[model samples]
Target: MMCLKTMMVCSLRQQILPILGLLLIIECIISLKLLELRVPSHVPLGTRAELSCSWQLGEHDVLYSVKWYKDGREFFRHVPRDLEPRRKFPLPGVDVETFDTSGGNVTLSPAVLETGGRYRCEVSGERPLFPTVSDHADMLVVVLPDHGPMISGFRSRYRTGDRVQVNCTSGRSRPATQLAWYINGEPAPASAVQSAIDKKTEDLETTSMALDFVVQETDFKKNGLKIKCLATLAPVYWRSNEESALKEKAISNQLLRSSLEDVKVTRADRVLANSAEFTNSWRHVVLLLCSMPNLFLRGLVWFPFFLQEI
Candidate 1:
């Protein structure tokens, strides 16, 4: 199967919030199913990686402890200590630079081929597997992307602060893929993307890897004003996802916030029981918003692309 690595351009504003009363109750009953043990299935040489892992307890029970291991050894750890539950990797031999406790994910920077190997994880609380959920997760490492990235978009020029931006987007047919953006011809920080696209093929799923940032006039004059997005492909298919071009304007804060609020969380944690499960088209919306200024000059556009978040 083919998979695409997307460097999505957006933030957690689109995160789904848990709100249902009855379904929340159901989540309470199946706490053991809270998370599945999973890894990138593939890694690359000299790059960061977030090895994702999760487990669940019945809604009636509370998460007690979670730990990750690389080849039968401890690397990352999370525990429900006292009144607070949090993720931690305090092991001396283990290494982790980016791990979001709320997301139940581990981040490793400058990941390498040597990093490729078998990985194990355990999650436990008050049950049969309360103290240990087995190896369930795997990790693989490979070569990284050859070139920086390729830039694609509808237009090349924009007035100062007009919201005209570019999308550094790419597609993949496999996992173990790495994708990201470059600013003024240099690599920039990673931005989370909230998106969704339709899947039409079975062994050829398209993953949109893109980077979106506010544009500046200097960006165009630089070396090539080349806005590029790159993705590294793995031989495995995490699952089927939709295809998309990551070159749309930014979505209005009001419209986006409204849409996000409308989304429903299907788990017990009414506030954020949902992890980053939903697929997203964060770039499309952002690209769409940035183009509004051009539309306004031509006539009138209803969406406010230039509106700043309050």
Candidate 2:
């Protein structure tokens, strides 16, 4: 009985081993996998965008078809066995210029604002199994500004306690650009930033934001303050404009004028002191002459006697 039990266990092990080996072989034979899908995260409007899909297949498998989808709807298809290997279906904002069947690449000329969405690529193997592999990525069609942000309404100089009112405007874009203000290399406080304004013209949009704050002593760095306006169009565009304002010199000029006046007063005091000293010396000379009256009388008598002897 023990021998029979041992034989039954051996039979079961043999059956399972063969089934597992067969399954491994089948898995190795059916290898259709997507390697990579290249989709640009951001594409500028009115420019060409190229998307690529790459895959790998087993030695025995052949590629059956490759399809591209936008927002879950198929837009392009390629079948090597068909009479027309490349075909495009109509999709809004999707313009298929050329399709490369060999490399699974699709090119879109002049991408528009509506072209931004989820993109997917599907690849299938030929014949019996028809194994399919797929991948997806998101894209955004952007309208970038032609220039950097513009700053206005800023004074060339500012003083402590003076109100500063300035506006930053971004160039036209698809979605309004985001604007930010930085004072002396730091982000401005929420209270300093006013409500943002958006101006739309046709399909493009422009953004403007105002900054209003009182100049503080701490805002000055090295006798100047830096004001910067940063504009961004998410994931793609970034630009900034900066202006430097000098600290007002009114106080310093006043101090300088006071110092000059003090110097002038000191000079005048010195001149007056010299004049008083000179007057005192002249008074002493007059008193000495008055004290020498007898000498003057002797000189007069001697002058008469000397004149008679001559």
Lowest lDDT 10-residue stretch of candidate 2: 21-30
Error of 2 at 299 (Å): 47
The per-residue C-alpha lDDT of model 1 at residue 254 equals 100
Instruction: Give the per-residue lDDT of model 2 (tens digit) for 69-169.
Output: 99999999989899988888999999789877563898997898889999999998887667788999999888899789999999999999999999999
Please report the TM-score between candidate 2 and the true structure.
Answer: 0.69
* TM-score, cand. 1 vs. native: 0.34
TM-score against truth, every candidate = 0.34, 0.69
Error in Å for residue 304 of model 1: 99
Off by over 4 Å in 2: 1-30, 101-103, 250-310
What local lDDT score does residue 142 receive in model 1, on the 0 to 100 scale?
53
The digit string of per-residue lDDT tens for model 1 on 1-310 reads 1222232222222232333544554455444664565677765556566666666555467676776777777766676574555444454334687777643677776665557667776766654334445555566655533333345553544444444344443342323244555454566555523242323244333434444455565555432344444454545322221212233344689998777666643333554423333223566676787878687565544345445432
Give the winner by TM-score.
2
Reference-based lDDT, residue 121, model 1: 66
